[model samples]
Target: MLLPVRHSSCVLSIQFRAHSRFATTRTITTLASSAFAEIISRSSSKHQIYQSISSDPFVNLSIEQYLLQKTPEDSNVLFLYVNRPCVVVGRNQNPWLETNLKALQKHDTDIPRSGSSVRNVLYVRRHSGGGSVFHDEGNLNYSVICPRDVFTRDRHAEMVARALQKIGAVNAMVNERHDIVLAQQPKEFAKQKDATGIEDPFEESTPQALKVSGSAFKLTRNRALHHGTCLLDSPNINNLGAFLRSPARPYIHAKGVSSVRSPVGNVSAGLVSSAEPFSMQRTILSIMDEFSRLYGSGHEVRDCASRLNMTKSEFNAGDDWVAGAVGEVQLHEIPEIQNTFEMMKSTDFKFLQTPEFTFSTFTTEEDPRLRPPLPSFLPPLTRISIRAKKGIILEASISTSNDEAIAQKQALHSSEILADRTLHEIDAQAWRQIIDSIVGIDYDGQQQQQQPMEEVVDHLTEFLCEKFGV
Candidate 1:
């Protein structure tokens, strides 16, 4: 486990050893408090830039929140980070409706790497409000914290567009939706210029644009935070849709935001060149240069521009404005950040923070959309509906066409048991037990009725387990 560091001049380091096959042993060295203090004190600086060396999503997000809350009102800050495989949902979004929880639970060892290991994809709820997004080592996340008075939805997005253009992604531009997309180069325009002998990157073309970056935000009384993801060269790009497409979407009526599907492309796709291979480090440097130009002081701006060709490590080491892992460790020392970090990783915040939603096997008065066909194993005319708030079942009902008195009584009992229970807490075994108790079992522990009712119970148990990922 990662531990918080205290203020001291001595070097603080820890070795994390994991016996599980999913993780590898590694040594983590944290910077002393003085280095962290210098970075934090720069809140008053006209322009500040920091990058996280840690890939833990929780740690990076916690640090981002700290900067947003602690930075001076007039200061402009830039934070860059890369998280390991994880699905991040908006603050008000429902995880069950936005992500494939079952897929996330399955160990993913298919990511192309030197030494691939089984890894569980994480689910995170961000502090900002927007659609859900996927993050990985190849995806670079940029966040800008600026005064609310001067903040606009598209200002930083436009800045990122300029950065992409500077790096030879000439078709990159900010779309009306505030997302950065690479306009498709029409076949006719592939080899020819426009009427003025110049191509407009922002011009709307015929084919659909390929989105490369998604933007989201959080606005405070004085500070406005705009953060976005830039896809570079993710190995799992082809598998992104599977993880974001929730199995419960058809049955769920959610009260929160839903992700708008888009055809995504990588920024590296536009960086083809015979002389130089695609480099994420170079792309990040370009973005940092643009940010510095827009907000850095004269000397700082020049310094950033001069380091464009330097490696990321060299740039971080030589630049006084850049803080790396040290800043990440010191962030945990702040009470507010520590609390926010713990809260964000807690079960209550992950599941209970979800907005009210309903799951119905059939159409209802309130949610009258056409329903999908139920499993054939379910009894004819069988219907199930559950209403939940903050992940706790508020009301539930189950019924079948059967009019037998015992069946009616069992249905009512099952519904009663479902009500007031937490959706995600019900494991497959527990759910099976609940169904068995209602349907009745013989002395030999076999289901009493091995026909319609037994099949119904089996189907419900499987459905709940798969949908909730318990």
Candidate 2:
């Protein structure tokens, strides 16, 4: 839609120029200049300016080139946030090993963010394998592109967190309006500084705090990732989105979470002493439960309402789903909502590298100058998209070898979420094949499945090795 408008404007301007060619040179120059100025001011509104300067196309552009060419004089700590608004895994993850490959792929983009964001896109991958989730603009995308020093672990991302806190505080204030104010009268902005300024003692005292800065410890009572862009000193001109759809952090949007929740709220302060991925805890339990029942024992994909007492229609799961190996064993059928489930295998893919690029600008009088008639590319900036989907795993494997041992191992390890057994319980072959598949070894493999159940890891990896020879 946007591309067409840009083209049409270009055509109209060209036609306007062609007609001007027949006029007197003085009149033609005057008209031409007017048109040029109008075009230069294409982004006439602040909102439009935000859209053009801070959305997808900018982020897609090479970060290095964008950074290098940024205006050196404008030194307010520039930040850019990029959110993948789809299903994103951790830095080290195995899609198959950690999630229901078939089910997750089909999980619909029921909720969407602004612009060209798509469903089921994997944005992050971690060493620990798990699941991907859905993310959108409502999730709060923030970035801080200041000097490299600003991003000092807790020091860097802290800015983004505090901003979210400020926003959340405002939201909370609105939620508790009657309490904040005894009557319905307005109160003045507080004398205290926001999260950042309060911590800075050296700065001179100020009665007013920037509205952008949020207050402290305003935890989101509801579930949802406080998301947005974060950039340091660099003028990070890019998309501010991060899909809040990791299994560790699932999208509660569908479950009706529309407010910001502090990251600290979801985590126990005691646990933060030796922080670990929170999703793995429950997810691992789910996996273990499934495996314990997977041996065709007492497993069945019973409706969720029958087990967890969840609202049947909550996940649209007519009933919340749970199963073991017995009556109704499930290998994860795609949900009916999003047809993409077929394409949405329990696949895990993410980009591991903090992709870097280079950009430069000089103060010379000639070309590539600080001021420009228009923001044109210099030497040109390029964008690179890196894809990743690998993870270290435990007690896993996959294979076409349906020997009794393999079947038994598969049954044993892949039981329902509570069947509970150690990885050592299964043999090396089953561990390698089934567990490996769960860990995402054969992710992009276009497996040759018949009409029904598809094969798992062992063969998929073999196929990939032969296809790419890596």
* Top of the candidates by lDDT: 1
- Per-candidate clash tally: 0, 93
lDDT of 1 at 5: 40
TM-score of each: 0.80, 0.27
Global Cα lDDT for candidate 2:
0.23
> Which run of 10 residues does model 1 get worst, by summed lDDT?
191-200
**Predicted candidate 2 versus true structure: per-residue lDDT over 1-470, tens digit per residue:** 01112211111211123455473221101111112212212232001000112223113212211222231221111222234343344323333222323223334332232234345533333221222332333222222222232222233233333332232222211111111100111122221111111111222122222212111111112211111222111111122222231221121011111123111111111112233332322322332233223222222221211232111111101011111110000112212212222222222223112122111122222223342221222112111111211221222222232244444444343443112332212334544454454323223245543322333344433332221112
Measured with C-alpha atoms, the lDDT of residue 381 in candidate 1 is: 60
lDDT of each: 0.71, 0.23
